[model samples]
Target: MLTHKGDKSGIRSDFISDYDDLADQWWDPRGPLAPLGWIARARAGFIPVAGHEQARLLDIACGGGLFGPHAAGKGYRVFGVDLSEMSLREALRHGFDEVVRADIARLPFDDESFDVVTAGQCLEHVPDPFGVVAEACRVLRPGGTLVVDTIADTKVARLVSITLAENVPLPGRPPRGTHDHRLFVNRERLTGVAREHGVELELLGLRPRLREMARYAAGRLEEVRMVRTKSTSVLYLGVGIKK
Candidate 1:
C-alpha cells in the first residue's frame, strides 16, 4: 500500500464542498442522490452480519449515512465518518447511531477499534486511496472485515458512469463533474493495498440492475435493484479480512 505523511491535507477541498452542497438530497429516494443509496444497499448484501450481531462497524467517507441504518438494523453498532459537516449533520438527522466529521485518511479512532470498516463509492474522491485503505485496516481488529466499493478504471466505466451519468444532463442524474475519471481504481490495485495492510482480499464485480439504474435516475430508489457479477470493468466490490 502507498504511504503518506502527516494529516489528510491531501484530500481535495472541492470534493468536500461538492458533497456539502448536496447534503439535503441524501434521503430523497427520488433525488439525484438515489444512486448512492442504491449502491449502498447493494453493497450491504455482502457484509457477513449473521454472527456479528454486536460487531462495531465504522464507515469512512460515509456521506449521508447511506449504510448506517441498514447495518444497524442487522444488529451492528454503526459509526460513520466524513469530511463534510453538512453531510455528517444529514447523517445524524437520518438517525445514524454515531456520526463524526473526520478525514478518511486520518480517522479519529484508535487502532483496532472496530470489528468492521467500510468505505463505499468513496475511494475515487480521494487523492490517496491506498493510504485510506491502510487507515481502514489500521482501525480494524484482528479477524475483522473491511469492505469497499469503487468505480473501475476502464474506458467503459468512464464513458458510462462518469461522462454519461454526470455530464449528460439527464433528469435525476447527478450534477456534472460529480466524478473525476482519473481517480477511478481497479480491482488489482485495491486488493494489493489490502494485502499490504495484512488483509486477505476478495474482489467482486457489481452489476447494477439495468432497470434499477433507470428508476434511480428517475428518483425512484425503491424500484432499483443491484446484483453481483464477475466482470469488474465497470464497478468492483472488495472484502478484506484483517489478519
Candidate 2:
C-alpha cells in the first residue's frame, strides 16, 4: 500500500508516511492491511513455478512483503522494493531475499533484470500507474510473468473501495484518509499500457467472499478471501506474460 513520492495528488505523502506508523502491523491478519495478504494469495495462482534455477522476482511497492510467503516454495529469489524504509525492513524479515527502497514508477534495475514482476494494490495510489506498468515490463525478461491488482476508477469503485472500505467501522478497516479517489486506476488504460510494453494483460475482477466477510466482521475469521470475477469494474487484477 505504498504511495508515490512525486505524486501530483498532494494527498499521498501522508499516506506514504502512514506506512511507518503501521509497519509493525503489516503481518497481523487483524491489522489494517490484512486485505493485501488475502489478495496476495489469489495473485499467487498466476505465478508459475520458476522456469529455471535461481529465477528472480521483483515485487514493486512490496509494503510489508505480504506476498513473500506465497512466493516462497516456488523457487524465486524474491526482491522487494518500496518507498517506506520501515515497510522494507518488515518485508526483509518476511521471506523476501532482499529489499530496495525506491519508487515503483522509476525502477533502478537494468532492463530485463527480472523473471517476474508484480505490483499489487499500489497502483491506485499512484498518479501515473501506467508509467509504473511500463517500468515493470521493462525489467521483466521476455516470457516473464507480470501481475498487478488495483482499484478501478469507476464510480462504483469509488463507493466501494474508498467510501465504504475506509469509512466502514469494521475491524482492521483502513483509516479514513487512506485512499484518494482521484488516483483510482482505469482498467482499459492499464491493459493498454501493458500491451504497449509487450505484455498482453488479462484483467479480472476481485471481490471479498461475502460469507467470509461476514465472519470477519463477526470476529469468527481473521481474514477474508478475495474471489475472482468476470468484471473488472471495481477491485481488479491484471496478469500477463512479457512477449
Candidate 3:
C-alpha cells in the first residue's frame, strides 16, 4: 500500500483528492468512474435480500452513491461513509439513507452495529488496507456479511489496472494518476485479515464482459456488465460471513 510517500511512477500520493475533483463525473456512463457503477451492480448480486426489517448496510468509501440504485428494493437502510465532502453530497442526493463524512481507516460506529458492510474500490488507496478491513469487520455483526473489491498487488495488476486502463483512450478510463500500483492489496493478506476478524472470505475474479465492453466502446451500449473470471491477478471481489 501507500508508504506515506510518493511512488516510483511519479504519480501524486494524495489519491482522495481525485474523488473530490471528479465528483461530477461519478454518474456519467463514459466517465472515469463508470466501471465502478458496473462493479456496483455485480457486488449487489452477492447480497441476499434482507431477512428482517431495518437490516442495516454500511457502504465504506461510497463515492457519489454509485452503489445506491442497485442496492435499492433489497430492504436495507444503506449508510455511506467517505472522506470526500463533495462526494458525500452526491451520495446523499442518491439513495443512501444517511451519509457520513469519515475516513474508512477509522470508522465511527460501534462494534457489531451493522448487519452488512461493503468496501469497494477504496482499499487500494490507503496505507494499510487490512486495517480498514478490520474496521469494516468491527462494525459488522455476527452472522453479518462483508463484501469488498480491490486491485491485487501483482505485476499483471499494475500493467492492466494502471498502465493500460489509465493511459489508454477508453470510454471508462480513470484519470492517469488515479492508481498507484505500489499500494495494491495482497490477496493472501486480505483473506487472512478477514479471517482474523472472524470472517471467512471467498475471493472471486471480476472483469468486464468482453463483448459488452466492445459494445460500450462503440457507444451502442450505455453500460457494460462485469462478469466472474478465473483469474484474480487484477481486480477481484471478496464476500464473507462473520463467524
Provide the overall lDDT of each model, using Cα atoms, as 2-decimal numbers: 0.78, 0.88, 0.90
Q: Candidate 1 vs. truth: CA RMSD?
A: 5.0
- Top candidate (lDDT): 3
Model 3, 177-203: lDDT tens digits are 787787899999999999999999999
lDDT of 1 by residue, 93-123 (tens): 6657788888888999999989889899899
Model 3 per-residue lDDT at 140: 96
- TM-score of every candidate relative to the true structure: 0.87, 0.94, 0.94
Model 3: CA > 4 A from native: 1-18
State residue 93's C-alpha deviation in candidate 2, in Å. 0.9
Clash count (model 1, backbone only): 1
Question: Candidate 3 lDDT (Cα, whole model)?
Answer: 0.90
**Which has the greatest TM-score?**
3
lDDT of 2: 0.88
Candidate 2 displacement at residue 228 in angstroms = 0.8
TM-score of 2: 0.94
